[model samples]
Target chain A: MNNELRIMQNIYYDNSATTKVDPKVLKAMLPYLENEFGNSGSVHSFGQRALAAVDEARDKVANFFGSEAQEIIFTSGATESNNLAIRGVVDNAIKGGQKVHIITSKIEHPAVLEVFKYLEKNNLVETDYVEVDENGVIKLDQLEKKIKENTVLVSIMYANNEVGSVQPIESVKKILKQVQNDRGEKGLPLYFHVDAVQAVNHLDCNVDMLGADLLSLSGHKIYGPKGIGALYVRKGVKLAPIVFGGHQEYNIRTGTLNVPGIVGLGVAIELVAKEKGPSKLKEKLVAELKNISDIKFNGDLENQLPNIINISFLNAEGESILMMLDMEGIAISTGSACSSGSLEPSHVLTAMGIKPQWSHGCIRISLGRFNSEAEVEPFITALKTTIEKLRKMAP
Target chain B: MKYTKKLLEHFQSPHNQGKIKNADGVGEVGNIKCGDIMKLYLKVGKNKKGDDIIKDIKFETLGCAAAIGATSMLTDLAKGKTFDEALNISKDDIVKALGGVPPIKHHCSVLAQDALKKAIASYKTRNS
Candidate 1:
């Protein structure tokens, strides 16, 4: 009886890492996973039923982005989607005998940054990284200056995963519009791609409205099943296939389709579309946290996603705080070098001009749709106690 | 890397935390850039055999779980021992007492050993 009383209730605030799969989405995917299972490519009644489900999912995903069904290409996840969008376009440009110069922001997820680095190292393309401001937003002037006449593609994330800063996609669209017109006069091709994995939950994602030639999103990040994602390739944007197999996903990505995952992704996107505005719990938590001394918040709070709150506690190391919280049945993430395999802290914080000492003390608390207001007070109480304990132990 | 159950217990309720007021000797090692800093305090006095002994020891640390656990274990090993015996306490001893830390955290035990040596040296320097 005493042991049962000592058990702490679990509270999860790591939604930005991944969300719990919704029960409705799982219900929608059950038929496809069980008796309705069939290879979408086979020629029979079972195959036709499976193919119809895939087509329905495709249409739902396409409708979410205001694109045609043929434009959406399913992949494993956002990493694959990002790889497909970037490598596919750049490889096509290279095959056309053009010297490719591509641009990406310094604060992009490694999926995009590492791909650019690989291309640059191999001499396949000339790459430039546009800088971000102190709030982790991309600098528009720097982006414009980095674009040379030979630049063929630019990739930027819709929202940063670590700090939750939302980039100014509208301003970026305007700049690209001007460049596109200039390049069009010379019959040159330039494309814009966005990694929208973190933005679909809270932001507008209509492909034409964002003026993106290609866009990437992951199912897991939006409360759908894992191992499924999609890429929005605009009509007339040519891309070479990176993975070779049976002709699937219009030859851009190949393999047997993940029918259940696809069905879940479609239902997840539709559900998030009806989700309400900014979370009041997040606002309350931030406001309460501000009452504590020696705490600094990262990123532009006004423009950031409603779910994420990144903060650094002076003198208290992040990994220590994270472990303490974990003991209390609360889950969070940290940017401390000690927590990661590599000794360096978060690249996003470093790119935003934060010092290593401050970056090592950073922790991220992200709320999800299923999280309730009742969980906030307990979390804050636990956090305050943990910080006090750590502060007392520190030199 | 995962910490052992023994290490987590030490981190959760560390031994002899905070400073000893007007300590006989104090030693601080590591730096903020490395993401760990350990400050050790010692109270040295003569034993019945007329040999210098550590009467009390405490530590304050700003680091991850391994750093704090290593320091806590070091204090437990060094207290009530003569200065020479305390100085002989190795990194392996502290690591062994706490089961073991991750390979990447082996430096934390090294830091603990260095802190003990520095404290003993400081006591000798003031008396000599």
Candidate 2:
């Protein structure tokens, strides 16, 4: 395709994968990338200016989460932030010779899920994966039943990356609080860690309100630059350092700051606070898609984030649909095994008890603030054509 | 996964797709669990030399680009070949004809080979 034609036809619906950088964020970051390049650790004037910028960015992020600036630790991205949050708490307990029991939901993003799996495989921690209902909402009762006296941390995502199911965070907070009160300091300290990467753009992330001891956020998911994210650790939470390096990010995460990315993230966070949710476009898209037959929508549509929609078209394989859409310059994602180059389909759908056949046919359409209503009809028209073609060829 | 332009072209516009009514033989391979299925229809006829040849071929596939493209390529290769020649059309040949598919998608071509073999075996059993 020619550049002009490609640009004219392109429509991106893969915001859950990553978002285009906001122009405002890019503008804010350019000065740091070009002129104000200095290590925040240095004591020179140039370093002082860089340090000031870092502090300002930290404050902006902290304010958005209703957390103290000191509580925020900047890391590479949500994957790193998740590692820091999950490993930091669990590792600290292990160092104290404590028998750690940790809990996480089955439908968590691999960033959080894999960390728990690694701990279990190494026998370093006893882990339990709380089940999710067919809608991919975590089972609160199962979570309550699985918490042991030694349960140190419970990691759950605020909104699932694939399905956009918003977990019952407030209820989870209440349950954890009651358990803590009942245990009354005799039991191991239990902290609630939330992977809020997908929720920051549309949900309230106040740390106190959510009762989150540690929370993870990604930059690129919120229209900020890639390779920069933040972890919020509450005032009294004690976490061991994951990386050893110069005293940076409260020494919890050690690396030279991604100065430009941090600046962009701060601006992006500020912008998202003012940005409207994609509910109107989501409603229009979903309603139009429902007219198609033999399709099942995944996730709890009533409780999900408005940005993401997951659906399975019976008989139409997801990779074929994705490829067909790609040919039309409409970008989307699929949960099919072929797309992942694995025999197993999407773990999220599998955990939700969706059959392999249905899971292989699933595709996720995630909207963003930049997506317009004008693009919706064209996307639906292309999708209808793609599904019809694939179904006609299906065996 | 990256697909060659040739493979993408075939996927976009597959050759001789859909079922042939009253086909001489029909075969289906792969399963829903593995997320790929290819069904091939064959019309076998006698050549001037009194040898069996594939007179017509068509396929319907529910799979990724590689599966669809490979099946399309298989039909092109087997359309006018003698029974022995069609039976010798291997997965490698299909892959080569499509430039190449990703290593993981090699199984898709394998499905195409299996479908053709099954169709020919069914046809021979019916005749005998």
Candidate 3:
């Protein structure tokens, strides 16, 4: 262990909450914060240089998502990106004389789910929150039934944070496929967006393959700095700008630009993506977690993100297990970083139909490049022991 | 896998846990979202002389073991003490009483402290 870690016990397995910024990505960002601090949109040589840097960073992110450079809009993170996409749709439909309807899943991160709620409350839009199965995936048939002529958008998360369940984007893609066909044309399109934050690292999301016209990604989740992310709005996708200002980001988004954060996000994306092979690593953790008595694995093991394993210990409460694990030098999360401080059960778990008893017992263990099998074996062992002890004593 | 002997003792034979349902003053806090609901009942006023001693203390926490453990310890230490005395009890006392917990588990102490203070505040709310 390094001196920095030696000063404190450091078993950081909570990549799902946020990741340690990659050294390479951070190193790449030093220049932007120092001498290269010119606005990307300016006209002078300094500005031109910074502008070139922004273009290169945009290209990197666009390439990562298999999208065109112009299609990507810089945002604060997935929350802002989700807000832009969903609300943009609602606002545009209102302007165009069409009533708005939206469809989303129950197990979405608050970013996506809350925007829908705001829209529904405003009366400008009506929403249908599709239910997730026991495994935390949406029923596509139910999604199909919810899709009315007024349904202007379907917003679902690319992955479930609490359970690590990967949604059937391809299946949802097929529905969008039929939507276009049955509507008789693709013009005046209804958008389909995925908050691809958790999936951005684990699942390969080529915009074409996923067939999503809009996708939101976060920098911090993929080993970049926080307060930065990007939105992928496919070419020909239309939504009026929410924040009015100068014609930045093709007049779709406004701001001087978060140059360093953008640069870091792009670099981090390049570094964290899996080269190949995932099932083995994830399966190993699942197998070990299952050996611990009273563990209930949330989400679809086969179809979920290989890096995330959410387990509920019937023997002990989730927070207790977390506390015990932290003392043992392991770091993880009970829910989204957004809701971690709350005493309530995670909305994501409850939406998966997990009972309160188990929900309170749940914690997400997300692995990253820094983790290893050696680290994992001990982790599972420690957790199992903790759960067993707590179970025997808890009334 | 077993919890530390110290932690188990706190859970099984928790010190100072009981309820005074007909408490002179009651305090409760509920997190509607987390579903970990806590209700604290306190029988306030003096034991015999007109001292500020707490008469009885109890808590019902629908949460994990540490929650139960911490709350149990809070009540164990607070009963029969003055209201001012009970309110002074910090999470440190609970952690010390249970022989220490992991730092992440520090939140449990926070919960216990909040529930305790709220219960005391509730008692004062009525007494005043």
Candidate 4:
């Protein structure tokens, strides 16, 4: 293979986009794929075996977030979970003929943001966006004011995928509680949903600790298989089904269960739960890149996830930087992988008040558990050279 | 967008990538939405036939690979052509020269062609 083809095995720094499946997780999933291909819904010995495995996996995944297994609902991925959380609640509110209002931040992932947009466009609900600071943290006082007589849902991402800014979810939950108390006479139902896809592996995700009534997470983010994820609905939250079919998952999300994928996710979450994340390597990467001039960190380093480092190179275009790094057999992203092909700059960064030019220049380096101290220097070297070359060529 | 090997080559070492000093004509194009900016410069001279030709050309672009590649390829295609011929180099020709740009990034190539047309127009007006 040529250098371009060989570059496929380059140092991957885009783990936040997706992670390579851990070998151990694959090993654990093999038996399910090979011999135990029974449908969990079937009423046979094979079905019972599959059902037991899925149940155990659910328990493991629920334990990862300090929840009961029955509260976890398996879905395709975080996108589905986010939709189930946001739309599910909205649909229920609509059925009750409530004047529903939804609150989200300007920097939410498109999974959450687009759902709200769809709801708003169709006149299903009125949506208000809480403003985020430069660090991408939602302003609590501003959020408090956005709460109105009919506010039904508040969906905020636990961590931004572009900038890795960890939102103060705990404080956000407290604010929601206070607002609920202030509106107790009217008894307007308010639910707090957290898109924790980016936070599950790098942060404390205990649902009670974060005070999240609904949380969405994907298995692939934690080095598990793709196409499998889980959503946590706190008991008695009264969520409606967005996808209805065979009445699986408490009739909330219904599809034939993915047996092997669930097995892989179970093992993957267990493994990540035991492993220390890429914090040291991240620190090393930041320190090495510090030598490059005109480079600015885009998010809060102290309160952010340990693995993701978002930076903007002044006078350099992000797509150019991305291509140059690819040429050097290094991998990174200009923004969310979902919108990499889009011409617009990152909505998350732009929402954080970054200038359009600077947002176009932003690049995210999201390390993974596989990254080591040894790769840090080489990555820094590649980044420095790429930025220098792009800046030199800049008008 | 997946760039062809040839496109990547030109993008890595774009030709005529610096601004020209006191040029005969200058054209600038920017996509406020995409945040891509390109400035094209032309140094026009007369051939033996006394028709205006581009004697030298340079560009300064702050954009994606396709934008830079289109400008680089545009400069190469327009360098020896008369002002009218340079104007005839369409966005498709530049896209073809780069092998292809992603459909979403075709605007980058279009921006390049626009910049060249504007440059030639600027030259004609200045000399007219």
Candidate 5:
């Protein structure tokens, strides 16, 4: 027991929030941050070197998404990528004096949902949210029904970070194709966007397979450095740049390139794309956790990412469980890291109609490459005992 | 939210937990938005000065660590004190007792203090 305590000093299981930068990714990024400092936009030899590196990174990233190099645009992170994709399309459509409407799922991350809300708030666009089942899968018929003559875009996530529910992107794409064909006679175009921040590392992200006209991804979610992400815009897609500045990223996004972050993101994507994730370890942990009474698992386990699992200890408070787990050096989260400090229940869970009490008690355990397969047994032991203790304290 | 070590201690093993059976006073406060609900139970008795004193205090709280810690500290701070003195135990006193709670969770300390006051008010009405 003492030996187990000694080794259990830093078992991180919160990969969905972010990942520790892979050492190989860090090794690749070091030169850019130190000596290889040059603006990709400049004309000097040093600048040419940086520009070449940037081009290489773009190609790698683009290849991971099954996109052409020119189609990928670098941004600050998934938040910025999401913002640029949604707002760019809507703002452009509105400028063309087209009545703009958007369709999104209720379980979308705030990065997507909040942008729609902002556009809707200003009367720039009309929006509708598609409902999800108890497992957090978007209802395809309901989504198709929400499409209107003026519906310019349908933005949905590739997978949910909190519950690990992988959306049926191909099905959504088929529905969009039908909608587009129906609207073709009227000369209307409906674009499909996906927030693939959580899905890029764990799932097949081929844009062709997913049928995404635009997609968003973050570096940190896949073991890259923070502050770097990309947006994939299919060639010939019209999108108004959100941030107006020096001509960069095909005039869709403008800023000095985050060279080190970009380089790290490329290597991280390459490394994680090959990883299948530790589902065996996850299943082992879940089976052990089920021994505790009244524990409910969230998301569609049959069709979801292997690394992320969310569960609710019926009578326990999520924050209390988080803190207790922290004390034992088992890091986890109650919901998205963006909304973890807030008191409100996760919007995703509520949208799926999970009971309020269960939602409040929900915590996500996301594994990653660094997590040892041997740690699963100890994690199970700690979680089982911790839930028992917290449940006993419950009123 | 970062909790002080003392607060963590209190939250893990609250000084006064469970319900006071046939309690003289019971107070419940629910933060609907945060989904935190605190129920405080109190038993009052006469002190040497013939003043109403808190004879027993217990709590059943469904909240974060700070909420549980603050309520636990409130019980410890108010026990054996006169009704007026217990009522005087402010949110600051609870915060100070547990080292401190984060700015976002200051309302937890406030919730604890408010629950105690409500319990005392209930006691006053019952005895009156």
Candidate 6:
């Protein structure tokens, strides 16, 4: 058994942070670089070919999200997508002579929450954090109570990256529909923005079911290249450009198109759609880990995205467990992808009303397609041994 | 990955585990929230030959396996050593006892050393 364990090397389990680029995605991207290098904006045969590549990628992305090809605005990833969505709405609302207000959740990824925090601090917008339950689902009554006549936008996630909790976006859309009918307003409809970075391939995503006016997704989160993402701006949902430059992504994002990146993202989305996604490893891992004593799952396991598990070992520190796991060649995360490398306990846990002691003991294990049940046994055995040893060491 | 033979020995069939209920000295270190806490109990002093060696050393730890393994190995390292000499044990020596820990958990072995210092300090304070 020991000899078999020695044969293993580099057990990469921290897929939620990022994934190794798929070979197919890489193959699609290669031509745009070394060989087919040309600025998409230049007006020659080379440039026109590059421009065609960009359009092809855009159409694939639009098909992936059930949106029009023109609606997909390329940006630097989910962070930029979120910034563009929030700032765009605020800039447009302020210009329309309305006091802009925003409603978000306590468990929002920092990309969305931090921007709202900055707005609230600067008095640029009135912001309200609709509280989430232990599973990190926003309370509909609380959301309704916070919404005012001036609420220009409501930002939420299609799925949380840390705990994999899927939000009831259809329910949120229903509430928004009721609010719109009560107010008798047609023009300047309330902006619904969904950060679907983690949901692109794992779940069946459609702009209609999400009922979002704007959707943000990153390429790297779904086996595509990093540093590139798309923002879905529904037609007639007018938002001023937050990033200034020459009209590149239809005057919405003003920069030369990242041709290789777009191609990779398109390939990733197409493969997932064609293959119908094979991420059952997440459920298998979670089911096995659930059998352990003193282990608590952090989110709504039933309705989760089937790719993440946030677990806490009683009387065990996450870093200590992580170090030992690293020794065993099994990789894992502490909590949020954005908060990696920071020693602070997860704010997501704190928001769920988890005790501070429990927060420090938390470990986030996200599964990817590359993982298999054959690889999971050693992880469980290693985790159990590490936890038992740590418990005995504590005073 | 297989733990080194020494680490597994310390982890599986560890020596000097549990607490000495009437311990002559006790050393406790690390904050509760950090999740690594170690308490060392020592029963030290002379034999009929006036030897100053430590008679018995016991530990109760609440932390990860490596920490427990280190704590377990630390006691074995200190046991039977001359009372004053045992106080001189360093983190390097403890890591050496377990065939070395992964770099990140070097602090756990270090904590065990600090705990030994604390236990020795308490013994001196009580006897004086």
Judged by DockQ, which candidate is best?
2
Query: By TM-score, highest first, what's the ranking?
Result: 2, 1, 4, 5, 6, 3
TM agreement with the true structure for every prediction: 0.96, 0.97, 0.79, 0.95, 0.94, 0.82
Tens-place lDDT digits, model 2, residues A66-125: 989999999999999999999999899999587889999988988998999898999999
Per-residue CA lDDT of candidate 1, range A165-204, in tens?
9998878989999998876765667899999999999999
For residues A237-328, what per-residue lDDT tens digits would candidate 4 score against the true structure? Answer: 88889877897888888988999999988899898789864567877778877888887899888978898899987888888888888878
Give the CAPRI rating of model 5.
medium
Report residue A335 deviation for candidate 3 (angstroms). Answer: 4.2
Write down the RMSD of candidate 3 (Cα, Å): 7.4
Q: What is the fnat of model 3 with respect to the true interface contacts?
A: 0.27
What is the lDDT, from 0 to 100, of the residue B15 in candidate 2? 95
Stretches off by above 4 angstroms in model 6 are A1-5, A96-98, A186-188, A277-280, A336-343, B1-22, B29-36, B42-128
Candidate 3: Cα lDDT at B96:
86
Task: In model 1, state the lDDT of residue A46.
Answer: 93
- Candidate 1 lDDT, tens digit per residue, B42-98? 998889999989999999998888889999999999999998898888888988999
Off by over 4 Å in 2: A1-8
What TM-score does chain A of each model score against the native chain A?
0.98, 0.97, 0.93, 0.95, 0.95, 0.94
Model 2 chain B: ten consecutive residues of lowest lDDT:
B28-37
Rank the candidate models, highest DockQ first: 2, 1, 4, 5, 6, 3
What shift in Å separates residue A51 of candidate 4 from its native position after superposition? 0.9
| Model 3: residue A45 alpha-carbon error in angstroms | 1.3
lDDT score, candidate 4, position A180: 82
After TM-score superposition, what is the CA distance of residue A81 in candidate 3 from its true location, in Å? 0.6
Tell me the TM-score of model 4. 0.95
* Tens-digit per-residue lDDT, A1-395, candidate 6: 35465644467878888988999999999999977788899999898898889889999999988989999998989999999999888888888566788998888889999999888888889999988889877788899888888888999998888888888888889888877777776644688999998887688788987899999989898888999998999998878898788978778789888989998988888877786555667777877888888878898888887778889877776766776677677899774211233434576777777776677678888877677778878888888887887676555
